[model samples]
Target: MDILKSLGHPEELINLFKFKIGGCRTIMPKLDYESMSESLRTCYQYLNQTSRSFAAVIQALDGELRHAVCIFYLVLRALDTVEDDMSIPLDRKVPMLNDFHTYLYQDEWCFTESQEKDRKVLEDFPTISLEFRNLAREYRDVISDICHRMGVGMAEFLEKKVGSMKEWDQYCHYVAGLVGIGLSQLFSASQLEDPEVGQDTALANSMGLFLQKTNIIRDYLEDTQQGRAFWPKEAWSQFAGRLEDLAHPDKLELALSCLNLLVTDALRHVPDVIAYLSRLQNQSVFNFCAIPQVMAIATLSSCYNNPMVFQGVVKIRKGQAVTLMMEATNMRAVHTIISQYSQEILQKVSVSDPSREKTLHTLALIREKSTLSQSSLQSRTHHLSPMYLSAAMLLAALSWQYLNTTAVQTQGTGDMQG
Candidate 1:
């Protein structure tokens, strides 16, 4: 693959981290795709754009781990896109989801005469749909094998009948929890990480839940508007008479209370993330862990105590994102980071209960896993090369400038290339 040179492997495991925070574009240069499967390339391009951080982590990996993980994300995202688009009706969408599942896990994924007849309808298409279809067809077995091993319990949960927050948590495991498991598998298989130091897959599930819960909570209004209801009936019953009624402004007070409970429960996992980050033996994994933790803290800070946080969608500003990243990078004490976020989330809690505060304590205990010795910390800092740091910062400034110029150029051409 011609791209292999650009996709050059990092000389040191720690350097792989540069990709984790910047997104996949950072490592696109290193991935040689000339000889790789077209379906894989199509997925890589999309995954790189959709999840820069995720892409970097993949870029840092080699061979089987990289291909398997990248394809998994590619297939999952394609299915997710099909599942989410409002344009497609459920009859078509459900089948597509089923097709995607079949393609992911089953060997009987070859397009039969029936499917070929269906394919003729898109004979004139010039896009990547065929590759997507092939991915759907050829990769299902591998996807199933991986997911089955990674998410057996979670799959059972997904199949279970839904009713409450308890159910929602179970659902999160099926959909998002397995992601943690799959990622851990890749990390473990690569042998680039310290299995002893990093947060195990089970603990990582809590971090995944925290993220997915935040997503569900933030998108409540938008998802409802789209005729989707991810929040379980059990949780909704605690507030409005019906799921649709939960959206009514008049019922917002009760809805907010329910949401607060969700967010509070979600925050309970931030410490686990801190613990996870601290245990990671690799800098790239650290970046992956840090960025999300920092983002979560910022999200909590922005939404806490503001009824408007749930009124619509909320996000952190670019400036705020930079600040959080810098803070996360500079702070050596994991507890300090968790403590700061704990205070932010605590301010948002509507009730003063010990159980809520106790969660923070649990997280605090997790943070202790990363504590560095005074001499070690001082020695590490003293070894830093100022010249290298300056060079890196200068490159970052130049990259931002180039991106702005390219954006302007692309906009003028009506051929936007990101």
Candidate 2:
């Protein structure tokens, strides 16, 4: 079924196929880390193994911040491993979450019960911890503080269901919003960006909230199948007998209504995201932040009022992601992308839809706030002809796979680098 869907919809295959082969090859540093300490080398190896998208961005960063950010990401990934492992007993998990930051200092702490995808990060955490300890005191303090706060937050919600809009925001803040705050602190500490640039905690929180909400909305099917639910009862309960009821084939309309409402609620964060992006000073930092924001808005656009949220994954095309990544180098580019996707969502919201009024109002705010001039909007719209777009995409996917393979060969690839 998935393969057929991929064939009929080549945009879906393009990213997966490319990511598997050569998604971020151009930005990656050369393979030889001979100058790095053994611990740093192992940590970088582990980071490359664990997260391709993040590894790509971290490597793109300038100087010491790159290493600091890499270690920071690994430490959090280790803490998140402990938090995300549902199979562990509550007694074990809760304490682990509460003390995860301290574990980064211990250098011997390791958790073996993480899900398979993340298990290596848990087992090899000592390498990450070693690197974490070597970081400058300012960087170490910020990473440790964020990990401590996030761990406690995850522990608080482990046994409770998210029941309201407020709870949803709190949960997201714990897991993701804090990440935004921590990164701001790191960027400021690195001296690469102005300290004042990271001070807007509310906007940083909104940036993280926007991404987290979009993921929750996109992963409805996967989360439900796995017995996890992050969408608050406040919205879903109004549309269905139960949250999982929307997943049943029989409740397609109600499911889409609920999905659209969630998307609409998530849109309230857009302006704040724009405000946050506008403060960034570093080009790499801007790219790192802007790509994800652009991707989130693009995903929301595709998922808005679309029934696929209940069916399977709904994603932006690889072509679209590459375009955004290449062109979204400034606030103006970011605004244009947001304007485009917001328009896409507004066009799709129907008058009869339950959330149409809320959706329209939210999108109008986005359109009004975007700084995209009419001339820029006219020059930016790029789409291939549908008839041969997929065929061309298939060839592009194959080319990326070949590029990824040959790039690894030339660069001395790390284990599980993809």
Question: What pairs collide in candidate 2?
Answer: none
Indicate the worst ten consecutive residues by lDDT in candidate 1: 1-10
Model 1 lDDT tens row, 1-418: 1112222221111222232334434323367889877656766666666566556556655555566566676555544454445565555545555445445434334322222222321222222334434543324344554444433443343334457768778777767766765566555555666655323766767777877777777777787777777777776677778776866778767766666656666776765676666566755555545665667656765665556644777765543443344345433744455555555665655554324565455445544554655464444332437685556545544554455567687673111111
Q: Count the backbone clashes (under 3 Å) in each candidate.
A: 15, 0
lDDT of each: 0.54, 0.81
Predicted structure 1, TM vs. truth = 0.65
**Top of the candidates by lDDT:** 2
TM-score of each prediction: 0.65, 0.88
Error in Å for residue 35 of model 2: 1.6
Model 2: lDDT to the true structure = 0.81
